[model samples]
Target: METLRWQDHTLYLLDQTQLPLTETYLTCTRWPAVADAIRCLAVRGAPAIGVAATYGAVLGAQKIAGETTDAAAFGDRFLAVCDALEGTRPTAVNLHWALARMRDVAAAALKTDSCTAVVGRLEAEAMRIDEADREINRRMGQFGAAELAQLGRPLTILTHCNAGALATAAFGTALGVVRALHAQGLVRMVYADETRPLLQGARLTTTELAADGIPVTLITDNMAAWTMKTKGIDAVIVGADRIAANGDTANKIGTYGVALLAAAHGIPFYVAAPVSTFDRTLEDGTGIPIEERAADEVRQCGGLATALPEISVFNPAFDVTPHEYITAIVTEHGVLHHPDSQVLHEFFRKEGI
Candidate 1:
C-alpha cells in the first residue's frame, strides 16, 4: 500500500514534496487535491505522476457523480478535471498523455447506460491503465537487461536521477535495466548522480538501489565527467519522460549534460523506456519542450535549516538528451539503433500506436 493507490473512495500519495524529512501521506477525497499534489510535486516522476493523474481523473469522476446522473454533465466535469490536472505540469508529456487517454475512456463511457455505470467503467479503465503501466515496466526491464547482457562482462554503469520503482508503478525504466542486471548477475557497480537541488539520485535512487543490494556510489552532478573519464564506466543509461519521433529524449535535469559527457568518452549511451514514452508528434529533440524550473530550486535549496547556509546551489528538474547522442533506445519491443527516426517510426508502425 504505497502512498499512491486506490482503496475505497480516497487516493493515497507519498507526499514527495515532504520527502527525505517528514514522511507524510496525502489522502485525497477530491480529485483536485490529487491534481494539486502533482502540481506541487507532492507526487512526481513522469509515470507515477501519470498514474496518479489517471486515478485523479477517477476521483474526479466520483465527485461529479451526483444523484442526477446526466451523461453530458458527467463528461463536462470529467474533462474539467483532466484539464486541471494536465495544467499542473506541462513538461512531463505523460501528464497530458495519461489524462487524454483517460478522457477517451470517459468519452466512450458516456455512450453507455447510466452516469453511475460510466463512473464504474471509468474506474475500471483507470485501474487497467495503472496495471498496464506496471506490466510495461517489468517487460521494459527484461528487454533492457537482455541488451545489456550482450555487452559482455559484469559492467560498470553510470545513471542520472532516480528512475526506480518509486518513479513508476513498477521496477522503473532506465534503473529497471540496472535492477534486471543485478538480478541476472551481470552488474559490476553503479554510479548514481546526486542530482543537485532535488537530489533524487541521492535521496530516492540510492535509497532504493542500496536496499536492493546493488553496489551504488553517489557523486555530485558535476562529478559525472570525472567519474566517466576516470572510473572507466562501461555504459551510461537513463529513462526518458518523452522521446520524440526522431529518438530525442527528455529526461531528468542534468541528463543531457551526462549524455554529452558519455559521448565524448566513447561510452555506450542507452535510453530505456516504454513505447508509451515515444511522441510521434514531435519531430526531433529540438521540438521537444524543455521545462524551465523556478529559480528558488537553483538558489535557495532545501535542507538548509540543519546545516550551514554558506553553500550555494543551482537546480533544474530535467534536461533533454539528443537522439544522435544516444547509441540505442531500448524499449520492451526491442533495441532501436541509428537512423533514429526511421527505427522509431518502424516501432510505431509495428505497434500501431
Candidate 2:
C-alpha cells in the first residue's frame, strides 16, 4: 500500500467536515486555521491530529516572524498558538504531547539563537515530530503483527473505525496490524464495523483494506455478534485515542460495546497504538474526557437511509474501554499485557514521552 505523506510547510488534511460525500483536502497555512480545522474535525484521528498540531506549531513560528519584531513577543505568540492547537481536541493525548514537545524545542531555540534561527529550528523540530510519527506507526504495526501471528494462520479479525493510512502519517495502529497480518498470510478475513455517525469503518477502513487487496466484510454495527458467532472471529483489534496509565483505552464510540462483546465471546481484544497515546498524567479511564459530538450526528443518517424529520440523537464520538477488556496494548516499543502505572511510567520515561 502507498503511504500518505505530509507536505512540508503545508498541511494536506482531509476535510472531514465534508466526509462520505466529498473527499476534500484542506491545505492549512496558518496556526489559527489549522487549529480551527482540528476543532471542527476537518482533520481527525489521534496520530493525524498530533501530526497536524506539530505542523501548526511551525506555521505559528512563521507567523510570528512576519507579525512581530521582538524575540520575546515572538516566543510568547508561538506558545499561545501551541496552547490553542493542543486544546482543539482533548480526548487525543497525542495532540498535546506532540505540541508540547514542539514548544519545548521552540523554547530551547529561543535561549541560544536569534529570531531567524528560532524559526528555522522550530521548522526542523516539527519535521522531526512528523517523521517520528511515521516510523512509530510502521514499527507498531510490526509489533502488532507478531502478536496476531501467535493466534494462528488464516485468522479472522474484527475491527471498528478508520485506523489505517488515513488515520496516521504512515500505516496505522490497529489497521496496521491487520495490514501486516495480511502481508504475512495470517489473516483470512476482516470484518469492518460500519462505525455509525461517522462511518469511518465503512468509508475509510474498508476502502483502505480493499485497496490493499485484503478481503473485507462490511456489516452494520449491530451485526458484530452475528459475525463472530458464524464466522469464528479470532480476535478484535482497535486503535486508541488515549490510554490511561491503568491501561484503559478511549477510542471511537461503540468500541466499548465491541470490547464487551469480544470478552463475552472469549475473543482476545487488543489495542494497538503508539506510546504517544499513553497518558501517564491520568490515573485511569475515569479521568479521560470523552468528546460528545453534534446531536444531529446521532439523530440522522447521512448515507443511504430513509429521512426522518424529527428525532433525538445521542452522539458521542468516542467511548472508553476499561482496562480489563484489553488483553494487550501494542506499541512501537513493545507489547504490554494488563499494564499498570509502574509499567506505563517506566515506558514513558524510557522513551522520554
Candidate 3:
C-alpha cells in the first residue's frame, strides 16, 4: 500500500496514529496542512517527510501562481512555504535537504520563466524526488541485506519503531533490510519493540509486517534485553533520522539503549538509511537537536489514561546513538564498516556522493 499519494493537487497521508485498528487518510491541499501532518507524525520518517515537503512546496507555489506579476514576489511565497515545512522537524536533515533542492529548482526556473512555469517545474521535481527516494530505499535494502549476510544469516532480527513501507516512499530503511531478506525467504521472524508512549512498534510496525505475511512478535520496550538474550537475535537493524560526520545516529527514542543491549549481548547493531540522512556540517551527535513531544503522549495510551496526571513526564521523540555502538552503517551507496569523519569523507569521495 502507498503510504502517501498525490491526487488533484493534494497530498494524502496515511494517518499513522490510527494504525493496527482503523486506517485513515488525511488530505492536505495547503502547505499549512502539510506542516500539521508532519508535526503530528501523520507523515513521518526522514525520507517520507523530505518527499512530502517537496510536494508541499509545489502546492505553495500553486497558491501564489497568479497572485504576483513579478517573479521576485512569487519566489517569496514559495520560499516561505519551504521555510515553514523545514521547521516542522529539526532532527531530520532530509527535510532541509529537500527544501533546499526545491529552492534551487525554483530559482533556476524563474531565471527564464513565469511563476506558473515554476509551479509545473516544482511538481515535476517533487515526483522525481519521490521516485528517487523509493529507488534509494530499494537499493539500501539490497546493500543492507548483503551486510547482514557477512555476519551470518539474520534469521531472527530485532528492530525498534515503525520503519517499514509506512516510514518511507515504499520499502523502509531499517525495515527495508528486513524486507529484502524476507523476500529471499531468509528471515524467520522479526521482534518489534513496543516503543513506549507512542507504541509505534506495537501499532504500526507489527501490523505492517503481519500484513506482508512475515512472522512478527511484539514486545514491550523494557523486554528488549530479555528477548535478545533468550530469543537468539542475530542482528539489530534500525532507521536513522540524522547521521553525524562521525556516524553518530539519531533515531526513534530508546534506540540508544537498544543498541547498548545488542552490543552487550554480542548482537551486531546495524543502521540503515539513505545517504541524504547524513549531515556533514555536524561534527557529532551532540549537534543534533532532540524534539521533546507533548507530555500527554506519555501519560496516555490509545486515548486512555495510564498514569497520574500530575506525575512528572519526559517525552523526547528521539535519542542519539554514539558511533562506537554502531557495528556498521548501510546506505544506498554501499556499506561502511565503521565510520569516523576521515573514513566517512573517504567513503563520500569513493562513492562520488
Candidate 4:
C-alpha cells in the first residue's frame, strides 16, 4: 500500500488515524494542508513524513511560482515552506535531512534557472526521494533478514509500533525484515505491542502484518515482558526515528522498555532503519530533542476518556534505547553489530557515505 503519493501536482496521503477501520485518503493541494496532515498524524512514520514533506515542498513551490518571477523572492518563499515542514516533527532526522536536500536543490536551481524551472526541479527531487525510500527499505530488509537468519531456526519476533509499509513510502524497516524472513519461511510469528496513546501498533502494524498473511499476535504494552518470557521470542526488532552518533536510538515511547526486556531475556534487539535516520552531529541521545504530545492523547482512547478530566499527564512521543541494549543496527548498507561511536563512524566512513 502506498503511504504517500504525488500525482498531477497534488499529494495523496492515506489517512493513518482511520487505519484498519476506514481506508480513506486525504488530498493535499497546498503545503499547509500537508503540514496539518503531518501535525495531526494523518500521515506519519519518519521516512514517510520526510517523503510527504518533499511533495509539500513541491506544492509550496507550485503555489508561489505564478506570483513570483524573481528567483530571489521564490527562494525565500521556498525556504519558508522548508522551515514549516521541519517544525512539524523535530525528533525525526529524516525530516530535516530531506528538507536540506530540497533546499540545496532549490538553491542550486535558482542560480541558473527561472522560478518555474526551480519548481520542476523540486518536483523531480521529491519523486526521487520517494523512489529512493522504497529501494532503501528493500535493501535494508535483505540485510536484516540475513542477520536474523543466524538464529538457524524459524523465529518468533516481537516488535513495537508500526514500522511496516504504512509507516514508510512502501516497504517497511523492522517490518521489512519480518517480510523478508517470512518470504524465506524463517519467521514463525510476530508479536505486536499495542503502543499506547497512539496505538499505532494495534491500529496499523498488526493490520499490515495480518493483511500480508504473516502470523501476528496483538498484545498490550504491559504484556511484553511476560510474552517474551514465555513465548520463545527470538529477537525484538523495531524502527527508529533518530540514531545519534553513538548509536543511541529514539523510537516509539515504549521501545526503551522493550530493549531492556530483550536484554533481560537474552534475546537480541535490532533496530532497522535507513542511513538517513542517523544524526551524526548529535553526540548522544541526550541531544536528540524529545517531542511531548498532548495530555488528552494519554487520557483518551478512540475519542473516549480513560482518565479523570482533571488528571495530569506526560506523554513523550519517543524514548531512547542505548546502544548497549541493542545487538545490532540493520541498515541498507549492512548490519552493525554492537554499534557504538567508533563502529558507526567506521561504517559510514568505509561506505564513503
TM-score of each: 0.93, 0.93, 0.98, 0.99
Runs of candidate 4 exceeding 4 Å displacement: none
From the highest lDDT down, the ranking of the candidates is 4, 3, 2, 1
lDDT tens readout by residue for model 1, 1-353? 25377889778888866665567889898888998888777787788888899889888888788645888888887898889988887667877788888988888878876878877887887788789888888888888888889988899999988777878877888888899999988888999998877788887778778878999999999999999989979999888888888888899888999989998999999988877777788888677776666555655557445334555544456677878899898877778875388887787788776
lDDT of 4 by residue, 95-147 (tens): 99999999999999999999999999999999999999999999999999999
TM-score of 1: 0.93
User: Could you tell me which residue pairs clash in candidate 3?
Assistant: none
In model 4, how many backbone clashes occur? 0
Residue 214, candidate 2: Cα error in Å is: 1.1
The digit string of per-residue lDDT tens for model 3 on 1-353 reads 57899888999989887777889998989889889999998888899999998988988888899677589998887888899999999898999999999999999999999888889999999999999999999999999887776655648999999877898989999899998898888898899999988888999899989988889999999999999999989999999999999999999999999999998999989999899999999999999999998888999988899899998988999999999999889999989887778878999999887
Pick the TM-score winner: 4
Quote the positional error of residue 213 for candidate 1 in Å.
Answer: 1.1
The local distance difference test score of each candidate is 0.82, 0.84, 0.90, 0.95
Off-target runs (Cα >4 Å) in candidate 2 are 1-8, 16-23, 303-312, 342-353
Give candidate 3 regions above 4 Å deviation. 151-154
Residue range 181-290, candidate 2, lDDT tens digits = 88898889899999988788888888788878999999999999888889999999999999998898999999999999998899999999988898877889999998
- Candidate 4: C-alpha lDDT: 0.95
Model 3 vs. true fold: TM: 0.98
Quote the positional error of residue 140 for candidate 1 in Å. 0.7
Q: Residue 301 of model 3: what lDDT?
A: 86
